[model samples]
Every structure is written in structure tokens, then in C-alpha cells.
Target chain A: MNINLTPGPSQLFYTVPDHARHAFKEGITSISHRSKTFESYFQKATEGLKELLGIPTDYFIFFTGSATEVWEKSIQNLVENSSMHLVNGAFSNRYFEIAKQLGKHAQKMDAPLGQNFSSIPITNYGTELIAITQNETSTGVSLTNDFIREVREKNSEALIVVDAVSSMPYPALDYSQIDSVFFSVQKGFGMPAGLGVWAVNPRCIEKAESLLARGISIGSYHNLPTLLLNALKNQTTETPNVLGIYLLSCVVEDFLRIGIKKIRQETDYKAAILYQALRAHPLMSAFVKDESAQSKTVIVADCGEHSIRISNYLSEHGFNPGEGYGEKKKSQLRFANFPAHSKEQYERMVDLIENLR
Target chain B: MNINLTPGPSQLFYTVPDHARHAFKEGITSISHRSKTFESYFQKATEGLKELLGIPTDYFIFFTGSATEVWEKSIQNLVENSSMHLVNGAFSNRYFEIAKQLGKHAQKMDAPLGQNFSSIPITNYGTELIAITQNETSTGVSLTNDFIREVREKNSEALIVVDAVSSMPYPALDYSQIDSVFFSVQKGFGMPAGLGVWAVNPRCIEKAESLLARGISIGSYHNLPTLLLNALKNQTTETPNVLGIYLLSCVVEDFLRIGIKKIRQETDYKAAILYQALRAHPLMSAFVKDESAQSKTVIVADCGEHSIRISNYLSEHGFNPGEGYGEKKKSQLRFANFPAHSKEQYERMVDLIENLR
Candidate 1:
């Protein structure tokens, strides 16, 4: 069997195939979104998420089409006049651009590729929200929890949102420090690409309500207020990805069974081995030079022009660690260390990397 | 043994379980959205839809989170000042509400509950687009083909949009008369909820470009320009509902194999029997008074107070024709006569209705 190590939509969670089969057999996909059956699925998924993530009591979890959508929704609902973005990679920069496209006065502090946002100070300057991509999927760089907390300390007035797309279940974030955090299930949750989970605190709702009070349009249908309204009733504003939500609930429950702390420990151990392999390689090294900023979930390595050859060679051995993203297509390789990936698999990946010619 | 005839997410196409199993086995769900594997799924689904619907060459097919989303996207990209809506049911009225929420001067001609838009005379005064819900799923009401065609003729300068959410593959709409049309997979397509297919002509593109030229915010990431840009490359603006898209391609191909003509003929046959049963029933009659206004796909009956009991009784025999929508919960019952619902099954439904206590 081919081991899919590509980031986001990587390896299916070990339980997914069984859960999906069960879902289909049970006619879970055939049930109406307005039905009590769907509400149970919604409640299970959202509650499982809150428990798994250690989310605060006042926070609300909402589902979206994809995590990329959360970027737009967050901007529309939270930011009335302006927002600030900490852009270190392609995905992070796109969020900033989305804010501008939405006609918000979006500002940004950029970092070099394969670098972290630890260097950037949070100078909010009247920005309604501060967007930080906690883990940059494109470059496999991440800001430390300490840096994120510092950002909150510096701009406690601005609503802080984190894009933990590629590194959820691995980040033990203090929700008390951030107003909102969003991620897609295709990544860390080990499901197919579809559902995006957005956790927002009461402050985010107050902001959206304030915008509504001022007659400023937040958005249509999926604005924060609308999503929260339906979420409270154990329903979505629109028909959601029922299959995805079902799978996510199953997987999150599986994670709960295994415990989040154990998952994080395993991820850390796996990332350490992979990075050691990259460091010992003859022609490659970990992309993020700063050890503190290196991602434990999505590990990127600089392989220069040999990236394609390395990817092909690895593919021959039934391993696919994904090709480079963005402009680094020929110069980097990414290997996702999701929960679905076994410890044995990462060891094999490390062995393959260390022995590469 | 449950025969789900709920309007959307009702009956899964016969081949769905097998196709889903095959997709899972083939690692379709695990494939990256940027991969060639995904592009193939996108191409097959889109091209198959075009052929099955007899969509023209100039029109591009794009996917969204749900059919509800196309409403917001259509308004955000196409309308600058005003758009006219033919609101008959809940879904149709919501589209008009979306436009107004987006700060557009949206106008509408209202139709009575369970009624058609035949009475709406297209008085387009500086309206950029004319929106029509070809089949309003909520009340099982439909606008006639002639009325939609007349709309285009009356407002030749305005873009004509048809929300064919529950009637696609049945409505052999003359694409030349409309600039855009949209639907979700779960409804008439007989797939699970998630993916929404939108067909837009080149004129819609021109209108979007014109709006863009004037610096109008036509939405972010999912704006027509961005969607079309990625769609041309057999991709979506973000990581879309991958499984939904895959299943769509499979189901659309299945539709093509059976032939859309045959599907439509069967639907017509099924609807006739259901409507006849409703007419002959003691406690129920067809909701739409005018036969021409009644929907062939989603059949609604005026069950008055016996709706729930009738629904539960049907469920005891393993048939679940959906209950009433919106305010008519106790007064009406809806039966979805989709392509997946066999003629024999509909006959059984009719016989059951005849013998109901």
C-alpha cells in the first residue's frame, strides 16, 4: 500500500474508512440537514472538538466550507475598518490579501520564506483584528506559543485569530489568549478536504453584533452572527458537508480515546527524527533554520533542485511526502506528520531521508 | 430498509455506496487538492455535468459549498446597484434577502405560497440581473420554462439566473436564454449534501470584469474571477469538498450512462402518480393549485393537520416522503420524486396513500 505523507489530505485516519462505511450503511448521508439525526452529528462533532482542543466554555465552534473560507469570514465579521496580518508563507499572505479584497484596510508584517513570525511585534495601531497563521503550511514554519501569547500581551485590544490549519491537535493553545482559531479537517484531523472548524470566543460575537448595530454588513448567510445562531441550535445556517462532519466526529473521538497529549508527544518525537535526518543529509537540511520555529506537523526540508528526484525516489518506495508548495516547487519537500501517520512510518521516512543519495 | 424520499440528502443514487467504497480504496479522499488526481475528478465531474445538462460551450461550471452559496456569490459578483428576484418560496425569497444584505438594491416580485412566478412581469428598471428559482424546493413550486424564457426576452440587457437546485437534470433549460444557473448535488442529483454546481455564461464573466473594473468587491477567493481562473485549470479557489466533487463526477457519469432524457421522463411519470394520489386522497390535496406550477421532482401535498401522522405512518412502512417546509409543517407533506426514486417505488407510495388510515 502506498503511504500518503502529503500535507492536508494526507493519510486517512485509521478509523475513517470504517466510519465512512458505517456512515454510508446507516444512511447518514441520506438524512436531512434539518433532522434530529443531523443535529446529533453536529453536537457530537462540535462537542468532541471542544473537548479534544481544551477550548474554553464561552467559545463557540462553527463549521465552514474550508479553512480558507474562515479567513474571509473572520475578516468580514470581526474587522469593520482594518485588520493586521502576520504573513510568513503563501497561505498566511493570502489571508492578508483576502482582507484587502474584502475592502478592509488590511495591514501586514511579512517574514522571509521558511521563517517564523516571532520577530514581528504586534503593533495593532487601531486594527480591529490581528490574524496570525500559527503554522505556515506552505513553508512548514511556525510561531511558538510564547510568541502568540506575547502578541496578545502587546495588542490585547485587537481580536487575535490563529490559522492552525496544518498544526491542530498538536498545538495546546491557550484559548484564553486568542479570540478565534480556525482549521480544516483535511490537515491534522486526517479527513478529506471539505469542513473547516472555527472556534470563536464571546468577544468575536460582540464584535460582529457591534458591526450589525452600526448597519455595517458582516457578510451574507455565513456571517459570524448567522453561523453562531444556527450553531447554538445544533444546526448550520446552510447544508454542510455531512460526511466530512461525521468523519471528523469519529476521528476526534478516536483522538480523544488516544488522548491529545499522547498525540502531541508522538508528533514531537516524529518531527525530531525527521529533522535529525534532514540535518544529517548530504544535500538537504530542514527548511526552517530556527529550531524553535520549525513545524512538528508539516516538516519542510530544503533539497534544492534535487527535490523532484528525491520525491520520485521516495515514491518508488511507496512513500509520497508531497512536493514543494508555492515558488519552492523545485527546492523543497514537505512531509506531513499527521495523527494518522504511524510511528513506524515516520521512522521509515527518516531512514529513507538519511540514506538518500 | 428505510426508503428515504426526503427532498435533499434523500435517496443516495444506487451506485453511491459502491463508488464511495471504490474511491476510498483508490485513495481518492487522500489525494491532495493540487494533485493531478484531483484535477481529473474535477474535469470529469464538470464535463459530465455540461454534457448531461446540455450546457453550452461558452458557459463555465464552478463548484461551491452549497447551492445556497451561489445566491450570495451571484449577487456579490454580478450586481452593482440592483437585481430583481422572483420570490415564490422560502429559498427564492432568501436569495433576494442575500442581495439586500450585501448592500445591493435588490428588488423582487412576490408570489403566493406554493405558487409560480407566471404572474411576474419582468419590469427591469436598471437591474443588472434577473434571478429566478426554477424549482423552489421549500414548497414544491416551479416556474414554467416559458416564464423564464419570457424573463430573458423582457430584460434582454439583464443577466438571467435560474436556481435549479431541485430540478436539474430534469429541466432541459434552454441555456441560451439564461446567463447563469446553479444547483446542489444532494437535491435532484441524488448525492450527499456539500457540493453546489454553478453554470455561468461568458456574459456573466464580462459583468464580473466590469464590476472589477469599477473596483467593486465581488467577494474574496470565490469571486467569479478567482473561481473561473482556477476552474479553467480544473481546480477550485480553495480546498473544496473533494469527496463531494468525486461522488458528483461518478453520479453524473452514471446519469450520462442512463441518459438525462430517460431520467426526466421517469421523473415526469413518478410525479404524475404522486400528484394523482394526492388529488384522490381524502385528507390531502396538491399544495400548488395550478398543475403547471407544481414541481415534478419535489411533490408537496396539503395534508393539513394529518401531515405528521401520515409521515410517521409512511415511515412505519419504511417510506419517508419529507414532511412540510417552513410554516406548513402541520399542513403539508413533501415527496421528492428524484431520478433515484424508482417508478415502482412511487407506485407503491401512491398505493400506500390510497390505503392510508
Candidate 2:
């Protein structure tokens, strides 16, 4: 059997194939988005997500095309003039760029690759929104919960938007401190790569409405108000990825049955195995030097000049790993330790890494 | 088995289940979007669409969230100041609304709901783009190819965009006259929803670039330039509906193997049977009064006050007909006659409609 370790569309949960088969048998793909059947699927997914993530009752869940789309949507709906981003890696930087492209005054506080901020940066500019990525998928640098709280405390008037793209359900975020959080199902959710889930509080909604009321263009269809209107009926603003939503609901159900506590424990166990192997290996080292800042979900290793060879070696052994993203493609090897990836798989992978010449 | 006759997200083509099962076994869902496997899927879908739909070499195919999205994208990219639309029904009206929402000066010439125009309306406005819906899903009104040719003849400089949302491959459009065309895969393609295919000629590209050079906000992330740059690499602007693209490729291959000519013939046969039954039934009449303007793909029937009763009767017989859209819900029933739907099934449905007391 082939083992997948690539990030984002990384690994399928053990329950996906079976659930997909059941979906096909139940004619899930052929159902109308307006039908009651689809509404039930929508409700199950939203409720399952709320239960699994411990989301507060005041937060509303919405679905979009992808997390990338969410970046654009958030900028269009929430920011009328300016937004600030805490950028360290490729994904976070893209969010800042999206704001600039949408004609917003976007400012960023940058950290070098493989390093993360321990505290929120002070910005003198007036900002309508502040964006943060909890885990930098490209560099495996993670921001702590405390750092997020600090950011919230520092910028009380600005809406705080969190990108939990590569790390969610793993990070037990305090919903009361966050204004909005978004994620694509492909990464931490261990599902296919289509649907994006955005959980927004009343403040974000009010911000969007304020922009609309002031005659600022907050997009057309699938904007925050339209999404909220459809979501009230357990529907979407557009015809969505129905199959992807169904699979996500099934996977979240599986995650709930396995228990978040147990999943978090397994994640810690797997990360320890890989990090320990990195420390012991002669040719490899953890890319993130700060242990506290290292991402538990995605582990990046600096392999000097042997990154390609090691990735090839792992691939030959029925293990598929991600190469470094963007500029680091030749110098790093990334491994994803999602729920679908068991402790035994990580142990086997670590054994292979440690034995590499 | 239930027969799905909804306009979109309707019936699955027979080959989809087997292909989907194969996709699961091959680990298609777990592959990264940046990986070679995903690139191959993108190339196959693009090539298969070209072969099946007779798309010219000069056109570029791009994917988005839904056909509704293409409306917004087309307006954002191609229209600088104003656009004019040929509006007859709900879907076409939406395209006009999208343009207006994006701060464009949009104007429309309306025909009565169930009628078609034999000639293009003369617009004195210096329109940058002209939008046309070849088949209006809401009213089952189809513009003839000759009518489209007339519109092209009238507006030589304005970009011509055709919405082939519910009718494609069957329409056999003259590509030389159109600047852009878009469709959602769930309708005529008989796949799941969430994937929109936009085919653009070079004129549309140049228009977008011209707007960008002038410092206009042509939107961000999935704008025309970004989409074109990625299409050259067999990739997308974002993590797209990967599974939907894969299924569309498989279904297009099936269509190519079965031959478009044969599929068109079968579609015609199925439509003729349903239209004839509507003509004969005591309680039913063709919703589109003009036989020449009626859509062959989606057949809408005015069931007077018995719309719900007939819909229930059909559903009890394992046939799920689409309820009327918007305000017409109690007065109409819509039947889809795509390739996935067989002639025998249409005949059976027609017989039941005629025998209803």
C-alpha cells in the first residue's frame, strides 16, 4: 500500500473510501443543492464541525470554493481600506497580497523563514483587519495560542482573522478571542481539496454590513451577507462541492468518534517520533530551530543537499513525502502528520529517515 | 432506483460510479494539486473537453467554483465601462446583476419570459461586452445559432459571451463568433456540481490586460491573467475542485468515445418524445410557446395548477422532476434530457404524464 505524506491534499482518512462508496449508493452526487437531502448534509457538516472544534454558539459557519478563495472573500467583505498581516511564509504572504490586489492598503510584519513570532508586533497604522496564519505550511513554523491572544489583546478594534489552513482541530483555539477563522478541508481535515470552511462571529458580519451600508463594494454573490442568508436555510450562496462537503462531514464524524483528545495525543506521539529522528539523523535537522515554534502537524526538515535523494528514497519505499514549497523546493523535505497518518506510519517513516546514508 | 430530472446536479452518467471507485482505489483524492498526477488530470480534462466540444486551439479553458462565478469573472475581466445583455429569464438576469454589482454600467434588452428573439436588439450604448445565454435554464428558452450570429454581426467590437450553462456539446456553437463561453459541469456534462469551465479567446485576455495596465481593479487571485499564467502550466489559480475536474474528464472521454453526433441525436429523440407528450396531455403544455425557441436539453412544461400533484405523482413512480423555479413553482415541471438519460426512460416518463388523471 502506498503511504501519502504530502501536505494539503495529503492523506485520505481510513473512513473516506467507505463513506464515498456509501455516498454513491445513496445517490448523493445526483441530488439538487436545493433539495432537503443536501440541506441535511450541510447541517450535519456544520454541526459536526462545531462539535469537533468546540465552536461557540454565536459563530456562524460558511462554505466557499477553497481557502485561497476565502483569502479574497475576507478581504473583499471585511476590509474597506486597510489590513495588516503577520507574514512568515508563502501562505501568509499570499493573504497580504490578496488584500493589496483588491485595492486595500495592506501592510505586513515579516519574520524570516523557519522562525515565528512569540509576541504580536506593534503597528501604528490604522488597520481594519489583522490576519494571522496559525501554522505556516511552507516552513512548519507555528504561532502559539498565547501569541494569538496577545495579538487579540493588542488590536481590540481591528477584526482578527486566523488562517488555520494547515493546522485546525489540532489547535484548540479560544473562539471568544477570535473574530473569524478559515480552513480548507484538504489539510488538517484529511479530505479532498475543494471546500473551504469559514467560521465568523457577529463582529465580522457587522463589519461586512457596515462596508455594504457605506457603499463600499463587498463583492456580489457569495459575499458575507449572501452566504449568511443562504446558511440560515442550511444552504450555500452557490452550487457548492456537494461530494466534498459530504466527505468532510463523514471524516469529521469519524474524528469525533475517535475523540479529539485521542487524536491530539496521537498527533503529539507522531510528531515526537519524526522530530526525534530528525535530531538523531546525521544529514538532517529540524528546519524550525525553535522547538516550541515547530509545527506539530507539518514537520519540515533541512536536509542540506540530500533532500531530493531522501524524498526519492522514501517514495521508493511506498512513502510519498512533500518537497519544500516555492523557493525551498530543493533544500527541504516536508512530512504531514495528520489524523489519517497513524503512529506506526510515522515510526516506519522515521526508521527510514534515520537509516539514510 | 430514483430518476433524477433536476436541471443541475441531476442524474449521474452511468460510467461515473465505476470511474469514481477507480479514483478512490488509485488514491486520486490524496494527491497534491502541485503534483504531477494532478497536472496530468488537468491536461486530460482540457484536451478531452477540446476534443468533445470542438473547442478551437486559440481558446484557453479555465476552471472556477460555479458557472455563476464565471459571470462575475467575465464581467470583471472583459468589461471596462459597460456591458449589454440579452435577458429573457432568471439566469440571464443574474449575469446582468453580477455586472452591475461589480460597479459596471450594465444594460439589458428583455424578451417576454417564454419567447425568443429572431433578431438582435440595437443598443446605442458603447458597450464593451455583450452577454447571451444560449439556453436559459429558468424559462427553457434557447437562442438559435442564427440569432447568436446576428448578435455577433451587430456588435462587431464588443466581446460576445455565451452562457451554455444547461446546454453544451449539444448546441454545436460557432466558435468563431463567440469571444468567451462558460458552463457548469453538473448540467449537460452529467457530473457533480462545483466545477465551472470558462473558454476564453485572446480578445478577452487582451481586454483584461488593458484594464490592468490602466490600473483598474480587475479583482484578484483568480483573475484572467493569473488564470492564464497557470493554465499554461496545466494548473489553476487555486486548489480547485480536483475531483470534479477528474470526473468531467472521464465523462468527456465517454462522450468522445460515444461520439457527439450520436449524443446529439439521442438528445433530440428524448426531447421530441417529451415535447410530444406535453402537447397531447390534457393538463400540460410546453412552457416555451414557440417550438423553435424551446431548449432540447431542459424541457419545461406548464402543468397549470397541477404542478405539485404531477411532480408528486412522478416522484412516487421513481422519477424526480424539477419543481418550477422562483415564482413559477406551482405552475411548472422541468425535465432534463441529457445523454445520461435514455430514450426509454423519457418514453416512460412521457407515458406517465399522458395517463395522469
What TM-score does chain A of each model score against the native chain A? 0.98, 0.98
For all candidates, state DockQ relative to the true structure. Answer: 0.83, 0.82
TM-score of 2: 0.98
lDDT of 1 at B247: 92
Could you give candidate 1's per-residue lDDT for residues B287-351 as a string of tens digits?
Answer: 99899999999888998889888988889888998878889877888888888889988888788
- Candidate 1 C-alpha error for residue B266, in Å: 0.5
lDDT string, candidate 2, B145-262, tens digits: 7887877787889999999999987899999999999999888888878899999999999999999999888889889999999999999888888888888888988999999999
- Summing lDDT over every window of 10 consecutive residues in candidate 2 chain A, give the lowest-scoring window: A117-126
What is each predicted model's overall lDDT from 0 to 1? 0.89, 0.88
Spell out the clash pairs found in candidate 2. none
* DockQ, candidate no. 1: 0.83
